[model samples]
Target: MLPVFRRRPRYSIGSKLTLIIGAVFGLYLLSVTVIGYVMYSQYRGFSTLASSHFDRAMTAAELTRDAETIAAEVFEMLVSSERSINAGNRRAENLASIYQATRQRLDAVDASDVVDDQTRAELDRWQQPFFSSLERLDTRLAAEQSLQAAHLNRIDELFLLLQQLPPVATTASLPAADQRFVGHALAALSYAAAALSAERPGQIARLHGACQQQLQQLAALSLVSKDFIELRKRLNRTLPSIFTSRRPLLQHGRATLATARQTRVLAQKLTSTTFNYHLQLKAAAQQAITVHQRMIRRSLFGLLLASLALITITVGAVVYIRRAIVLRINRLSAAMHAHQQGHDGPIPCEGHDEISLMGSTFAVFVEARRQAEQQLEQANLHLQQMNAELHRLSEIDELTRIANRRRFDQHMASVWRRALREQSPLGLIMADIDFFKRFNDEYGHQAGDECLYRVAQALAGELHREGDMVARYGGEEFILLLPGLSLAQTEKLARRLLRAVRSLQIPNDQAEGHMVTISLGGASVVPTTHDRIESLVSRADQALYAAKSRGRNRFCSAVADDQNVMVGGTT
Candidate 1:
């Protein structure tokens, strides 16, 4: 021999499978740990970037809105009239408060780490000028408001003097010429008052000239009253002061306009700065997304590689298992299935593996089970025949061979439900031998049983409809279920049944006509959820009593009333 080499030790399928599965599980665990770590890191980074930038951007937007609103309010103050000045000032104070709150919010945002030093500096630079412009605008607005108030006061004084002159013109003590001069003065005063109200400078000046001419003419009249002279002196003092107050109100309006322009420019600059800051945030967010995308792609690439390796390993293991073990197991399974279905083919039992041992054991088990199954099937067949006979005997009376009380109850329930669903009439008949107890007493129990069987057969044979059924309710009593039969139809069928029983002519010495007969009490009703099946049975029993009370061998029908069953009619 050149060189004798020892054979490699053999391993069982379980050991080899465990080793392959363990290796696969280890690789899977390593891949999952690496992927999970990379994904978690990327998620944390993205979450931080998104939250910080989104919050800062929202704060910047709020600041921009407040700034524009403040600028609009300033312009509104400048153009407002004296009547609205106080209201505008109140609104201005509220806007200033809002602007301050917005600034505080911006400051809070700037304090966060999201804001860079350059952005904070730029924002601070814009905020200072914006605050100063708002302050200057507020000051000019206050000055304009004060001038308006003073001008209104002077106008009020002029109106007071004009009112006093009206009473003087109405005085009867004055001469006619003096009265005419007083009227002319009152007319000029009215014109002046209108001019002041209109806020027209030229109209006020023209009215002042007309008033001066009227007062000078009245002074030339020596007959003027002492009161008139005093009133004229007061008018002369108040009118010129009203004219002077108008100039300052105009100057304040011009100053307020200049301040509004400066405030608007500052607000624009602040808006621009906030917009730029927002753009920066958007760019930073985009950059973060790009970087995270790259990370995600790398993670996905690693996952794909891991998945491919797992797939390759799994496939190789599956091919090995299929060839080594699964094919044999499948053939054994198929053979077992075929044996169960009555084929006696052999099971696959090859190799020294566990499956081969299992297959050999299974072949013996299959034969034993098949023999047992055949014996069990014969026993099942005999048991099924006995069950069918028991079921039949349970529902049918032994002597009469018709349905018994149990079957009657089940049929009543089934028929009632059908009638209720279809909204159809269900007719029930409670039929008895005309004198059943007397008949049984006169004859023996054997003859009584024979009579009951004959009567049951007669009733069942008389029912023509497939849905109709007759059952022996108890000793010497039978019930009929006629679905879709009205009271009239039920009575007609009951009469036919009575005749059919009498035609049998089974002798009963105690019965009517010395022959067998039946008295039928029948009731028909449209079934309703509110009504009970027992109610129908009771109504039929009542009608049966009525038929027997009237005469033997008759059929009586009953209808339902609000409180009780009323005997409808008899046939």
Candidate 2:
């Protein structure tokens, strides 16, 4: 044999490619890690700064809302105080509790680093006057309430004297002049009483003067009885006290009003200050975001320049290896494209290279894809079935197996809009199973549930119209939406529903007739853009209350020609 040359070591295309790719990848990974570390550090700093600003902003917003709520509650307390003194006291106590809690919150905010020094100083400045004004308001309100009570008691005493005089003046033993004096004194007392009731302090003062003069003339009379002298003495004591109390009551009321005005002004100023501070914090957060975004853009631009250089080096290396790798990859790519276009065939894999391995993987993937497609089709069908079941379950009551409140609400909204468009009458009936709670107590919850189910079914059976819908609104309560029905028609249907449930004869020892019956309230209204569905529901609710009040097992219409009428059921 010709001299056997030593076989040269084989360097495959993959080994050459690995060397070039590993160098390029290592350089790219190093640059990326360094850049990412720098960017992440900056991002973390920006996030912390922005988070602090946002937290402070949120705290300021909460302070503003609390201030507004306090102002509203104060105004409500003032208004309610005019009607009932007990109510006023309760509101005042509640206001005090709310104020104390708000004060604690303010103190916490002031002590915290959430707010800057300037904001903290402003808050401190606002807090002192606001708390002072609130304290003054509380004092004046208490004093006014106390004086009012004393004034009422004194007026009652004066009335008692006036009532005693009426009997004395009618005594026939008195002289005509003394009788005239007693009559004039009675007139002055009456005027004073009227003035007090009407809250005219000036008129009361004038009446007090007239009464005092009359009292002196009566005391000088020779024909005065023991009762007359006693009455004059009581009046003399009572009028001066009443006169004294009235002035102070009036003064306290004025002071309370003035204090309330000052408190409201301070509260509004606090709200404005906090709101502005919140806006400033928000702006600072935005500025931080803007600055961070600029830094990110600059970092990304540097990263992009480095990436382009790496890509240029990668392209030069790839061009050298293109003939070896690109031709085989293109062949595999064409096969994948054909497979995508529904031409499923085996990939022509020949060499033991990376491209050949990809071909084997693609073959396995094709088989997996076929199985996944079948599974996907089954999953889609199952999802559709589940969705339909969920929709049904959502609309049906689990306990009653009737339309639930959610379903009723949706239908009512749609029907309301339709009625508004057509300007037709829409009627609603609110019905309750009478003595259901007591029935639950007598029987058990299971029996109560059965009762509700039967009642819901009975009510639903009574509605023959396609547009009529009966739904279980809540526990033992059902609502019927009867569109296109007038009030008369609604009432008629309500009566039928009442009788239908009574006909069931469900026994309950707690209920009247020893049977379960339902009370129905019906309201009908012609739809208008100005009318709200809530108003219609409220009217029906009122009618339902009327039905219950007139004794259960009856139908009540809210209004028939501006009159409430109830249809009573015979036991």
Candidate 3:
């Protein structure tokens, strides 16, 4: 792969910085552009949806209202027909005229399609029964009037209750109180003219005049309010008196009947129109709400998608840059340190990517740095040696000369690696003075130092070959490295050292029984193969723990074949 996009050197640092800034800016712009596209798409969809639904809802509302209005007007006419007929003032002809006008109004409501069959039936029931009752009352009155010219006493107080008969029992029934009943009554009245023509000619002419006057007055009655109660009462009494006086004297019984029917019809019409209008408005409002919610949801979804895409791109960019630059820099930095220490080979090259190219360039820089480090290393070596000597001088107790921590780490790595490569059996022993800290307080730091030195000497004396090495591991601890030794031999040497140290009888005031005892942990491994350094150390450490657990003044050996663990000593 190519390392990186190359830019001309003629572009100054400022120019390069500007270009990088532009690239970052362009990424932001692209995000904004995508978001804008989403928002714009949502806006268009919402606008289109709103426009279509709004007009439809409004039109339906208007049509529903118009149909209900016409139904109300027709209902009024039907009620008036009853009034004219009962008063004995040519009521049938009057009905026939108003009925025609009411029919024209009802035809408009039918065209609007808001009224159903049930509504039509209700209207017919209210108007038909009422108008029929008027005709029946007229017939009864004419017969009674002709008989009264022969006999006068039949017209009595019993005639007053004729109006009190239930409307349902009449020739045609009256409407219910609600608005739907009013619409039904209106539809019924629209066809009343044909029914009225069945009345006699002299009565029909008088009925035509009565129907015209009643229509004018009933239409005006449609505007009745509580505030007009007095005016309504006066008109009610006056109109009935004038119309009733013209009737055959025996027809007086029908007065209240006609008035009641007209009232019921008016009430039904007002209720039906108001209720239908209300339903239409509610439907329109619901449609608007549904459309609004859809628009909001679409916009929110667009925003969510855009936000997710932006986050994904941002995370991807961050990961790519980190792997490309940060990880490579860290690897290169580690390799450079090892080379400077004269401890490792050159860095590896895996690709021609920017990180790889940078690594290659850094390798050259490190080589030059290494030459410089060589001169520095020589000076550092001399200084390090002096520092080590100084540390040994201060820390080494006069009685026991062994490697301190300052010197131990400096030598352990080299010796351990060499032993591993040679495949020689290597043995390690860790010896600790039981209760050394208490012993030191009981005695003194000098006495404690002396006691430690003597113990170290005892361990050194047990060693028989040049391959065996002894060192003071800590204030009251010592380590012995024995090469070419098996597990049995290493244990024997450790036991001997423990015996020698015990014989010294160093004062350990903290001891409960035998004082100044020691514990030894040993490991013997053939170093012919390169095993892990940590694993070897861990095995030896485990052995030391076994010895300590068994009690002080003992030695533990790790069996290398099956890695058998044993703590062996005379307790």
| Top-TM-score candidate index | 1
RMSD to truth, every model:
30.7, 56.4, 27.9
**For model 1, the run of ten residues with the poorest summed lDDT:** 1-10
* Comparing 1 and 3 on lDDT, the stronger one: 1
Please list the residue runs of candidate 1 whose C-alpha ends up more than 4 Å from where it truly belongs after superposition. 1-39, 82-84, 87-126, 155-187, 194-211, 214-233, 293-330, 337-343, 350-352, 360-571
Please provide, for model 2 over 1-571, each residue's C-alpha lDDT reduced to its tens digit, 9 standing for 90 to 100: 1122223226656697889989899979978896878678687966766456555556666666776776765676556546225454445456556655655654554444544788757766886787677777777777777777776777778667766765663547767766875776686577557656545667767867876677677667665467666766776666666666677666677677778878878877766776766676667667767877787787778788888878888888878677557877888899899999989766756566666667767777786787788789899999988998899799999999889999999999999999999989999999988889999998999999899988888888898988899998888888999999999898788878878888898998887889999888889999887988998988898888888888888888888454557866646
What is the full ranking by lDDT, best candidate first?
2, 1, 3
Residue 140 lDDT (model 3) = 50
List model 1 lDDT by residue over 1-571, tens digit each: 1122223336667987898888889988988898889879887977876566556666677776766676676666656555236665556567667767876876775555655778767877987887777777777777777777776777777667666664663557767766775676676566556556544557667766776676677567665467777866776676556555665565567667777778777777777776777677667667767887888898888889988998899889889889887887788889878887878897777676677767767766776787788889999998999998899899998999999999989988998999999999999999888777887888888889999999999999998888899999888889999999998888778778877898888998886578988878888899888999998898888888877787767877776562323333322
- Tens-place lDDT per residue, model 3, 1-571, is 2233333336343454466557556767876886787677667756654554444344435534543443443344335433332333343435434554554444443343344566555545554544555455455545545543432222221122222233433424433322232232232232223223223445644654554454344444443344233433433343333223334332443443454355335435533543454354346546656766776687677667767766776676667556755676677778777876767676755455555655666666666666777879998998999998787776554458865654554456667777777766777777788778888888989888888888888777878787567777766777777767877888888778877877877767686454688878888776655476556666776777777787666787777653536656654
Cα distance off (Å), candidate 2, residue 428: 99
TM-score of each: 0.49, 0.41, 0.30
Candidate 2 lDDT score at position 546: 82
Model 2's lDDT to the true fold? 0.76
Task: Give candidate 1's TM-score.
Answer: 0.49
Q: List the residue pairs that clash in candidate 2.
A: none
